[model samples]
Target: MQFIDFKKEHFSHNKEAGHYFIQISKDEVGYGDLEVLEKQDDDTYSKARYELVDDVSKVTIKMKNPGNIRVSF
Candidate 1:
């Protein structure tokens, strides 16, 4: 799973660093969507969408089934 960590400094940082916005305005950023990968019986993954929770300082993803799940943004 790959995560964009907003916990770091903006604009200049590593891959996990946040600042994912392409353009920034005074009070808004860009619109983005997330992709989820669900683990299958063969240990492979399949594209799936469940629920994504975005808080002020934290982000969460909920899956229908409780198992190994990976998300990309």
Candidate 2:
């Protein structure tokens, strides 16, 4: 529930700012996961496997369940 709360806050604040996509990358497997709190339009957001592009800092994620995401940047 805390994660959901955080996700909601992130979406509410960022959606207004036009941040439609959020990517999360980790160095190790099972570091963390993302979950959807709300949905706007037809976008789907959910926890997904990130494709490692470069280092741990760079990653590519597909928004399967469109919603807001909350992760430490």
Backbone N/Cα/C clashes per model: 0, 5
- The lDDT leader among the candidates is 1
lDDT of 2 by residue, 1-73 (tens): 2332234333222355343344444542234443333433466444443222333554333333334443332
lDDT of each: 0.44, 0.37
Poorly placed runs, candidate 2 (over 4 Å): 1-6, 11-19, 28-56, 60-73
List the candidates' TM-scores in order: 0.47, 0.24
Candidate 2: RMSD to truth:
8.3
Clashes of 2: 5
